[model samples]
Target: MTSAPALEQPVSTAESAEPELPTPVVAPESLSVKFNDVGRAFGGRTVLRNVTMTVNPGEVVAILGASGCGKSTLLRAVGGLDVGFTGELLIGDRAVSRYDERTAVGFQEPRLLPWRSIRRNIELGLPRDLEKSAGKARVDELLDLVGLSDRAHLRPREISGGMAQRASLARALARQPGVLLLDEPFGALDALTRLKMQDLLMDVHASTGTTVLLVTHDVNEAMQLADRILLLGCPDSDPAEGATVKSLVTVPGTRPRNRASQDLARLGSQLYAGLGVDSH
Candidate 1:
């Protein structure tokens, strides 16, 4: 039998160095929220200080790190939940003084009203000018988007955890907020359910293109979801010297990711390294 020629292997040399790959570029604009030398204190205890960073419009920024890293506190400050801080906090070219409906926070829990049906919960974000039919239509559409259209008439207590969270997301979107803040929204769910919710969140982002800022202790979760990961370490020795932006790592992986894949593993390792943690 005649032998076929073997394929030649490329030689590795100093010239090869590291192969450069194209990176996705996002345009820079005025900060959605800018914290300049911002500091916060409470009862002689400081939770954050000199923490500065800009949240871009239509950007998905995930804050990830250990507990007590002040990630949640920073989110609260930007959302105008914490007014004890001193510094500049600009939200879409405007200073944040009072909490505006334009910024909506979706917490770990669904927090839906049991007395009201899923439709009512979703319509809560609509304005008074929205007529009953319009509001109902919006609700029905959101329910369809969340894959819970048939459950619109069901109460919060009647739905599953995943379904409830889907309803919560629909309600949050119904407001048409420019900025959406999520604080470990899937933290309370089981591993499988959490994964499902993560996919759903990504789907929503793909369709709505809403600016999302999520806070989570799970490094892998941050790597899988955020376009940019913002690490906030714990406050320093002095209360005045509070938590700051440890690092901002850009995640350039494709969506609908496989958590077990090597790319995700490398990304998680990088995130851990950003937190000053040694990973195996």
Candidate 2:
């Protein structure tokens, strides 16, 4: 395991007063995903307010918060599922509202069609214009990438929960999307399986360098997988009123992370403090 960077020095009140923050190291030229002081409201409820952030290429960001903090809603916005929010979201210079083939969402549920085998499920995520043979070949590769090659012929119901989830990941990666949105993708698995899945995801991300944003209630999970973590503060009834980013903590650990390293524990402590949770 590699050592983490030195702890960030605290900013003095005077230094903070100057404002004008520095740009992110990996700034996307046109902003792959930008939320410009966005606000979202539902009927009489406000889910998020004054939420601003930029997601660059080849990064994995995690949104962590309480149940009603609008984490899922934020993911929905970027996924192009909710259009009622007041904000601007761009994916590679194009607004998320506009159809773009460069993004895909993977939910907690495998949601694979029982009739379709693992290979076909992944193939479905590929573009229609891809030649059938080429698409099938790509699907085979993804299955192997996710460690599901041997289970390629199995139906969703036939595999273990972890295997099913791995297949779901393959489906998400099949499109070769620049952006991958995940909503609690590993929330349902056993603890050991969840850890294995996280390692698998890290491997996939390392190989593909896809921009990923995942929403989860687990602080440890967020700390383990994210390059940076953002907390969605508690929200009001409106989708866009009171919610805002409570804190943003960058993970300074080395690549191919060792789960037991003290660096991860330190990062996890900071993340927990940001969430107002007491770390054991």
Candidate 3:
């Protein structure tokens, strides 16, 4: 993973006592998500079972678990990508039976088109009916939002993995999705890059207030990003059994949190234990 550049700070002048602050951009109201006893199976083998949860509007929720614990499956259910699942999965007031413009999904891979420039790639996320000029403006705005304005003309191959991931995030938000579904988006990055991505995600979330449902196996990633962490696991050690919610942990404090705080450390220990891992 590439080292993340330090976040730029405002430079003060001798004549000016304070630096100018950018106006806050309030994101539009986001939609809520609801899962009612959701379950999925393949070849008579269950993967998810009786998984029910509610993600309030504008909330950042993380679904976490061990490998094959069905966390990604649950997120796919919300995105209407996994139609094989049973039970009701709702985004806002509508059932998640078809692709809805209100939602957007970002996968573990950047999935960018090498042939297209970064700006053009992001434009792919815009609504088909949007006017050409409007789409261009939207694309430009998103490029700036993700801090890729300078690299707009570059192709995906020309950028670092971290920058490419940032572009992927910009593409997801290009439509101004009410709910963003992420499936281990930062999992491919190294530890340092992952930390940088998490910080960038928080900054974006605060600016847009878009609802986020992130699926990740890293406990620290979930703890650092989510308002609440939903732990999924099977009742038995067998993989044939379906997974369900094992526990729901609410991370204390507000945004721009201290990851190494004692409170978070204690909570992390408990979460580790909940995953059946030895805390020591």
**TM-score of every model?**
0.82, 0.83, 0.89
Give the per-residue lDDT of model 1 (tens digit) for 1-280.
5754543223456676443521111111213766788877778677677777887777889988778768888788777777777788878888876665567778789999999999889888675676888777777767877889899899999989989888888887776667788888898888998988888888777666668899998887887888888888764455355677778878866676676888778878887876768898
Flag regions of model 2 displaced more than 4 Å.
1-31, 98-100, 235-241
State the RMSD for candidate 2.
Answer: 11.6
TM-score of 3: 0.89
The candidate that achieves the highest TM-score relative to the unseen native structure: 3
Candidates by TM-score, descending order = 3, 2, 1
The CA lDDT at 97 in model 3 is: 65
Which tens-of-lDDT digit does each residue in 86-162 have in candidate 2? 97878878787633567778888988989999888888788778798878777877876788888899899999999
lDDT, candidate 1, equals 0.77
Q: Candidate 3 residues 67-155, lDDT tens each?
A: 98888888887887778899988889988866667888998999999999999999888878979998888788778777899999999
Q: How would you order the candidates by lDDT, starting with the best?
A: 3, 2, 1
Candidate 1, 19: how far from true, in Å?
41
User: Runs in model 1 with CA error above 4 Å?
Assistant: 1-31, 235-240, 258-263, 274-278
Question: Cα miss at 124, model 2 (Å)?
Answer: 1.3
Runs with alpha carbons beyond 4 Å of true place in candidate 3: 1-26, 237-239
